[model samples]
Target: MTAKKEVVMGASTENPAEIQDGGAMELVRVPAWEVKYKLDRNPDELAHFVCCRDLDWRRAVCGYEEPEAVILENPTTFCTMCVEVVQAHGGVPGSGRCPFDDQPCPDDETVDRMIDERTSRP
Candidate 1:
């Protein structure tokens, strides 16, 4: 049997304070004010994609060369860049965040409903 390493989920390797587990860490999508860009991004490209760029050490994780290129493409992961873009443009008019933003564990009723719906689907 192998030893189970305790993992500190959602810890940024860039920050010394976030490191809790002595083993591997999980990459976080949220960008706190102190986070520096660890991913490989070019300065030249960074100059153009202002829509996805945050006015901080965070780099363009989306890697779009032009401004608002992500909108032209399909959105997948929830990132700080996406949040910045949405908020910068007056944000969502009403309540309720994007369904993709986070995956909270379904409550008992919600889970039961989902299971019933899926089972009933043709």
Candidate 2:
């Protein structure tokens, strides 16, 4: 059996969750305060605090709408819903529900494919 090669990547704040070299994209842990500072008044830029689940679906990720969400996802006072979903998803949920979204769950075909490819090995 060959071990899967791990590649560490740093995505720009403009495009945070891009999957690189066919690898699962791990979100860079940017502090909520720093994000606000960098974003300034750029509405298009992402202001994620608690993995808004708004990332690229191909990367198998996203949710919240900012400011308030950022505050809620603070290390000291994260929202219960956010924490629960995060826990359920193993840090990054394949089909996790976002606290901001009304829908219960989101589609994640990438995760299904990854499971099949990794587990079907003999």
lDDT against the true structure, each candidate: 0.29, 0.31
- Which candidate gets the maximum lDDT versus the true structure? 2
Candidate 2 lDDT over residue span 41-122, tens digit each: 3343332233323332111112333322111111232334444555555543324544334345424465334323333424
TM agreement with the true structure for every prediction: 0.17, 0.23
How well does candidate 2 score on lDDT at residue 48?
A: 26
Off by over 4 Å in 2: 1-62, 67-75, 92-122
Error of 1 at 83 (Å): 0.9
Displacement of residue 11 (Cα, Å) in model 2 is 13
